[model samples]
Target chain A: MTAAPAAVEARDLSKEFDGRTVVDRITFAVPRGTTFGLLGANGAGKTTTILMLLGLLRPDRGEAQVLGHDMERDRFRALQRANFSSPYVSLPHRLTARQNLTVYGRLYGVSEVRRRIEDIARELRIEDLLDRPVGKMSAGQKTRVGIGKVLLNDPEVLFLDEPTASLSPESAAWLRSFLGAYRDRTRATIVLASHNMPEVEAMCDSVAFLQQGRLLEQGAPRDLIRRHGKQTLEEVFLEVAEGDTGRQQGPGDLA
Target chain B: MKASLGRIGAMMTRYMYLYQVSPIRILELVYWPTFNMLIWGFMQEYLRSATHPAVFAASYLIAAVLLWDVLFRSQLGLTLGFVEEMWARNLGHLAVSPLRPLEFVGALIATSLIRTLVAVGGAGFLATLFFGFNALELGFGLALFFLNLVIMGWGVGLAVCAILLRYGLAAEALAWGALFVLQPLCGVFYPVSVLPDWLEPVARALPATHVFEGMRTVVQDGRLDIDLLAQAFLLNIPYALAGLAAFLGAYAVARRRGLLMGTGE
Candidate 1:
């Protein structure tokens, strides 16, 4: 059988702000229905790369594509089938979770929006919080509601930035399990950008490490750990972050 | 581009939800317009009592106050629509949604119309109740004057949004104060002829100047000056176009700078 087209792809995508290059010519692709993780330190351009892929930021060079549509030329088509969630981004604080979801559902053109919102609220275990204003909810609760916003349309491709940040251990674990189950059921492709290594290790089918806006390494978590001769992904991360100048390494070129 | 009415309606729904939930917000829409009407209405009475009673009709000043709000409230309505998203840090979410920028702007304009109607309606109602002056007495001139004023207000409102997007919240003060710069120049409370010889030309250049001038003609002469009305509509075409171009240009710059992802109060 023929392979399905990549759900998300970036070809030498670059972006610069005020003469400073924040995202260099980075390139990668995610196979259909798999989770791809973008791991980087703060100011490492992970967010910028994701923004370009989502067509939220214009690239200085190259292109990003989602669901076989060029993001720059035809992002609206891809966006209609995709959704994104980030902890840094927020829903309107004064609106209730249900209100926010209803708005989003309608924007996504989801039919029977009320029923969809109820289903999402139940699945996210936010049924009770749905009626409460977003500002009154705790951070963890807000995060789940944010995820519900992403799931409203049952996006074919999902972009998640730090999906589990600031959650308690139990809450984070629950969220991961829920996400994994959702992927299994829907086979939706997810691209995650996070500083949480273990979460990346547990969630991503393949991961890319970016240093100073450049792709430094990319592979399966186990393969990367074994190649670097480290016991865990965190140890390998510390070495990549501290032991080498970011410009020295190329993807899979470690001696 | 295929714009989605559903997306546009969704954005309008969010604003309505915010409007309905907050008592202070609902009260705020009518408060300032009503307050301005009462003060000016009372002051107009005092001027008639103290000065030449025949110099200006008693309804003239009250009508000016009511019409001026069409400009003020419409401008305020549009800017507040955008500023609310910034205050909530919801711009990033909006940026990624299927909702197009033009569609979002359309939603802002629709809400501004609602806000202008509510505020001006409240103030007009009070003028008739407290003072025996009804703004409706201006007849068809009132509708034409309102249309011209709203368009002029929207032109300024879009320019203010461009300023906010380019400079972030640090430039937020301009949103509330931008139209005030035009107040004196636009003859909101006086005729353009009352201005200094040097400033008269500058005042006449503004669309609101023509609008207010037309309003005075309707009230004082009880006839519409077709020239002023026509000038107001003609001036608005370019003014509104310039505002739209500035806003779209600023949006492109913000996208390049990646400001849409992080812009917030």
Candidate 2:
């Protein structure tokens, strides 16, 4: 049988700043409708790689395609079908959550923007906080609003950077469940970059670990744990990150 | 282009929402212009009485104040718009969206135009009430002069934003200070001829110099100097183009350096 096409594909993607490499040559492919996790510690270049995939940061070498569009040459075309969210980035603080949603909705060219905002707000259980200024909302509330903003366009590909960083355990659990359900319902692809090991293990169908800008290993969470002979993904993560280089698989060897 | 409009309008809506929520923001926009108009009105009255026979003294000063605000407000509008995104840490969010850099800059220009109109409108009203001078009395020339000054403001504002983009907050002072540096050089309140012989050519190089000189012609000669207007518009094209290039260049550097996410506190 023929293989399904990739929702995201990168080949030898690399970046450097001030003579220090931030993202080394990393190759990976995320098949359509799958959840792929990018796991890395601080300065491991998770955010840089995500930015490159989104075409917000140009890679110094190699290339990427998202939703089958070349990220470098046709990013706008790809961007229309994708959306991103991060706790580090925020909506205008002074605008009410509803206003923020409306503005982003309009920018994404969504029809019936108000209705879409309402639907997403309802789905995310943030309807009550919709009228509150984003600055006044709690971190958890802001996280939910950020997710709602990403969902406004019903994107085919979702790029998330530390999406649950500031959420409470309950909210984080709820988000993971919601993302799983959303993925199943729409068969959409998700590229998650997170430091949350448990969250990655639970939500990601496949995971890639990065160490100092290099792809240390990649595979299903279970496969990685088994290969590293670890009890959990976090232990495997620690093993890879701390330079306990074992028989780890390379890029595109996830299967 | 249609997408550009949607993105641009969305950006403008973001600022409009800020203005709507904060009465202080709206008040701030009107306050300075109104205050300047009031102060200038009294000064103009003194000049008219002291000069005794000069019919255009009050009109000239009021026109200068009104036109100067147009330039100032337009520039501030664009710079502050960018600063707001930085302050909110929203640059990364917008960067990943379908909004192109050109569209983002276009939105800043559109937002600046709106801000310029509101501020200049308030000041012009104050000028009319306090000094009995209608800057609009300059007729169609007023529109041409306003366009020239605003375009020049965009040029300067874009360049300042570029500097800030590349250098971060340490360079933010340029947003406010850069324009003032040009104020003396542009002869906003005085004739370019007043400058030393060595500096006259430097003053003449600024589009605002020709704009202000054109304004003086309208006020004193009671007729538009098509040549001066043409020179102002011509000079503005290069300034505006340079501003655009500078901004695009800075944006490229910021992207490559991954500086967009943390530009503001």
Candidate 1: where are CA atoms >4 Å away? A1-3, A241-243, A246-255, B1-3
Question: DockQ (Cα-based) per candidate?
Answer: 0.78, 0.77
B-chain TM-score of model 1:
0.97
The CAPRI quality class of candidate 1 comes to: medium
Candidate 2 interface RMSD value: 1.0
Chain A TM-score, cand. 2: 0.94
Q: What is the C-alpha lDDT profile of model 2 across A1-255, one tens digit per residue?
A: 999889999889999999999999999999999999999888889989999999999999999999889998999999999999988787889999999999999989999999998899889999899999999988878889999999999999999999899998988989999999999999999999998899999999999999889998899999999888999999999988766333345444545
Best by DockQ: 1
Q: Return the TM-score for each candidate structure.
A: 0.96, 0.96
How would you encode candidate 2's per-residue C-alpha lDDT over B117-204 as one tens digit per residue?
Answer: 9999999988888778888889999999999999999999999899989888788777777888888888877898889999999999
Ten contiguous residues minimizing lDDT sum, candidate 2 chain B: B50-59
**Candidate 1 residue-wise lDDT, B53-155, digit = tens:** 8875548888888988999889889999999988998888888888888898888888999999999999999999998898888888889999999998888
